[model samples]
Target: MSLPLDSPALALRAAIHGALAADAPLAALLGGAKVFDVPPKEADFPFVALGEAVVADWSTATERGTEHALTLHAFSRSGGRAEAMAIAAAVQEALHDMPLALAAHRLANLRATTAEVVRDPDGRTFHALVRFRAVTEPL
Candidate 1:
């Protein structure tokens, strides 16, 4: 069995679980505070921002070599570009520690030259692209 690239939230959870199987430390990427009648806020406060990460999709097992791809996005209400990049770098470093087996033919290859922070007037989201390959030898 193999994982799919447009995987659901559950699948994303599984991918995160697998990536973080080593117990690495990371901060939250989203969800904190509400922009209700409380007050007006700037879009650059560190604490005002939230961090999130998920594996958008990856390849599955097939007769042909499996090509895995993952997209990680971080969001912030304040739209802090620097903060988002920092968080993205942390996530990328964590992913590097994935216990994927090179011998077992399980490896992740990065596609994007760099992780970028995407910001809209509404919010900010960091983007990173990674590709993986999974192979099994013949019995």
Candidate 2:
């Protein structure tokens, strides 16, 4: 069977997308960077992609929970590391230790695990990887 909307993975992703889209600091820095569940093919630079979600069973006999390993990517073409770093900072600020209201699941917590800015092999593209850990349980 397919995963439900209440799936911790989906809820966590949506929460992140919503937070980034609604944050003024992020908007000012990226200026309409499209956030996507998958990397866009024909989109312009400075886009945000919701990357992988690795979920594992983190449950007790009394409750069922999921530990989600999440990655969000930011791509930039200009301003080099400085620009990517700024955007990455915003991502971290927006997400780390932030509370999220999940659809059908309860978010126990969300915290950033790592934030790294890497120079793409293309030489002109900058890649920012933002990783997080989220624990969620049924509502």
Candidate 3:
């Protein structure tokens, strides 16, 4: 009856990182698996960042669970929206309905909800935001 160290947020981020790193399509799009919670100094273009997650309790009569609101960001500086859009597609395809492992909980379900691609005000960078929902229960 010990408390779990892997919060819903941590589990979700780890799943995303693992999924993207393992997907060849997404790996190639980013020129490598470049998933991170924080991008490095002068990090390479076409990388991914795990953004904020708004979570809520989803307890049932028989089990404890959670519903997550997650955001994944794709960034590009190689110019144009094409690369960004393609990477976004790969991200969505990689995670949609795919299974993920949780360190301290069970992932009841995971699915992409919505996504959008846009050019930044700098006109040279492209940004794509992908959103997802997940249901988890304590293991």
TM-score of each: 0.45, 0.93, 0.91
* TM-score: the better of candidates 1 and 2: 2
Residue-level lDDT tens digits of model 2 in 1-139: 7887667788778888898888888878878746777765887778788898899999998889999999999889995788888888898898888887888888898888999999989899999999999999988
Task: Name the candidate, 1 or 3, with the larger lDDT value.
Answer: 3
Q: How displaced is residue 120 in candidate 2, in Å?
A: 1.4
| Residue ranges of candidate 2 with Cα displaced over 4 Å | none
Model 1, runs deviating above 4 Å: 1-13, 18-24, 28-64, 101-113, 123-139
- List per-candidate RMSD values in Å: 9.2, 1.4, 2.6
Q: Tell me model 3's lDDT, rounded to 2 decimals.
A: 0.86
lDDT of 1: 0.40
CA shift at 97, candidate 1, in angstroms?
A: 5.4
Q: After the best TM-score superposition of candidate 2, give how far the Cα of residue 103 lies from its true spot, in angstroms.
A: 0.5
Write the candidate numbers in order of decreasing TM-score: 2, 3, 1
lDDT for every model? 0.40, 0.86, 0.86
lDDT for each residue of candidate 3 in 1-139, tens digit (9 for 90 to 100):
5435678767777877888888898888888889888889888888988888888999988889999989999999876888888888888899888878878888888888988988889988999998999998888
Q: After superposition, which runs of candidate 3 have C-alpha atoms over 4 Å from their true positions? A: 1-4
Q: State the number of backbone clashes in model 1.
A: 11
